[model samples]
Target: MSMHMEQTVQPPVDHSVSYPKFLWRALRAATDGGPLFYGSMTILTIVALLGANAWAKQVVHGMAVTDMTDHVSWGLYVANFTFLVGLAAGGVMMVIPAYLYRDDDMHDVVIVGELLAVAAIIMAMLSIVVDMGRPDRLWHLIPGIGRMHWPISMLTWDVIVLNGYLLLNLHVCGYLIYTRWLGRTPNPSWYVPFVFMSIFWAFSIHTVTAFLYCGLGGRPFWNSALLAPRFLASAFVTGPAFIVITLKALRARSAFQIPEGAIERLLSIVRITALINLFMAASEVFVEFYTGGSHTASARYLYFGLHGHEELVPWIWTALGLNAAAAVVLLSKPLYRRPGVLVAALVMTFVGVWIEKGMGLIVPAFIPSTLHEIVPYVPSATEWIVTAGIWAFGMMIYIVALKIGLQAMSGRLVRSDLPPAVGAVPQEAE
Candidate 1:
């Protein structure tokens, strides 16, 4: 004899009826809730406040407070901004698996990445603000009201895509999560097409960011055809790894269960992406060193020492070492199975990509200036404080959003009155 079982599925749920209530409930759930949740938010808020204060100092004191110069104009702020944009785009990787691939577990857990994308986009914009000496003049970017530079400029296109992507994600996530909070399945027509668009928009964000950097003929290090590919590869690695770690944490803390095959699938994605990323890095390196020219100066400074300035050498190598270590661990099925090893590998992958993308990619490009001046750049105290604050602020957003996600997943915050279970009944009568 054989037996089959199934979950009670809701039939054609109309979620709008309870949606207005979900907003208040989710907001309340964010607050009048758990100790640990609020505790983390408190710490992140303080950090954000501290960062805001530091930015105020920059506004008053001037750009002299930072180590940036005409030669190396963009520093920690832009680097972080660039990195966060990649992080935001990477969120779509999760959505692809969940929606396109029809992975049921990933579909349920999709909100985690959506929350991450929102937080990251917010931080990326914040980074842009803090990096500018004239943040008050930001409205100039507005189409009709401000600077109005678009169609002709890469930066303008970048601004459009980044903001558009952010808003698109916000809508999709808000609609889906709100429906979930109302204890109803979302209308497929509402979010399904948007989900597909997000996948393409995600690629655009990273590709545009790479073009922004690589378009600079003045900086040969970033002026490579490989930049966009590398950006996508690294994003694939870090984004899925982040989701995996978050899933594990969620599994441990809440009643929300991550499906059995999810982690394994994520690990496989990381393995493949990491391999491509490393390959691209090696290819770029070989070309840079083998065909030596003024074009290779920035690469030289990054890999070895340029003249006497070897500052970035150690940082780049450290990033490389961590990436290699992470790839090795991830590639091994036996080691990847261990929880401790898995966590450590994911951390290594994220940290490695952070350094590689931020410091390694940005700082070195400006070292050997067009005038052949070697300017060794290091972040200022104000830069560090502000950078730390941006991350803290983003973390706060992610944590709160993730908390609400857990509630929705565990069916604690909202109880869906699903239809009763139905199955074929055994019959003896004809």
Candidate 2:
């Protein structure tokens, strides 16, 4: 008898089973029919659709309908886009824990984080496209067509690197998850390149963003060498904060339980990162003030106040205090060990970082403006609506990706009969 036939046969399976049954079960679990998920989704959908309509109207009627004047060309949408991009890359920082330490608990969540990265990048691209005066002519940036501005510009390089990194993330993430669904192993050779590229890309996105403002030389506040490091510190804290919050929400909503051990471990990791972030901010304060140059003046304008523009100063101080307090709380063994304290720490860290990195970063760059004039640009209603849509879209993308990933991992909806595969592989066949 053939070896295959000679093998002890397993119980006969019914090949006639309905595939829809499997698919429906997976879909239901992912959607969960919860008010929070669906309600948020509905609100976002309406907002996004309205934003899209408004954009179309702007395109047809010209940019006059919106509040973007010459003084503040880049409004709320652009600022939010910048923030979200950094947040998207937040997950990339965790690769150190997973690969370097071989922490298996982080493995399952890593891809989910990567998916968030992908969504954030897409949102950035969308925001940029929308902000363009001549989005139709955007294609001219290509080599064969228009002036491919290079060598003279970091943005040219940024364009190349950001898109390449996005593709690499998608490929690496898609291959790994798809293969898992197919019950197969990834081709390590292919994935290794992506893994290394992803690490570099993570650093590149934030570095490029900092350079975009700093390299101008005119913007003294942004010109500091410490800018890149600060960007990294902020990203490290904010990204992890977002993940912790999301994971907690997931555990609460889903049947899958987050182990007390896992929660504590993640809390400790976030606390350490948060402390590092606070340390960097404090060091920046010392260096900027101690140096006592044009840059220091600008920094003071941001931290203390500059003329009437001091509107953000008190809020900024509040953010700084909150960040430090949260970091201390997390660093404590007893607090970090507790789920409630951990959650609170993460919440504070996330909010504080959002304020610090979002407003603190952007506002500081402009204050004591390169031109030495304080041009306060408040966001318009249109801008707020658009920002809401963008945020919703990001959450929606994350929700969808997480649901799909969980289903594949749990052997629901389009799952393979074989054991779960870990890393990169093909997408289609079982």
Q: Pick the TM-score winner.
A: 1
lDDT of 2 by residue, 198-273 (tens): 8888888888877776787767766778877777777777787777777787777775434444445566667677
Choose the strongest candidate by lDDT: 1
Total residue pair clashes for candidate 1? 1
The 10-residue segment of model 1 with minimum total lDDT is 421-430
Q: Give the alpha carbon lDDT tens digit for every residue of 216-260 in model 1.
A: 886788989899999999988888888888888877765566676
Task: Assess every candidate by TM-score.
Answer: 0.91, 0.83
| Model 1, CA-based lDDT | 0.82
For residue 64, model 1's alpha carbon misses the true position, in angstroms, by 1.5
- Count the clashes in each prediction: 1, 1
lDDT of each: 0.82, 0.68
| lDDT assessment of candidate 2 | 0.68
Candidate 2: residue pairs that collide: 186-424
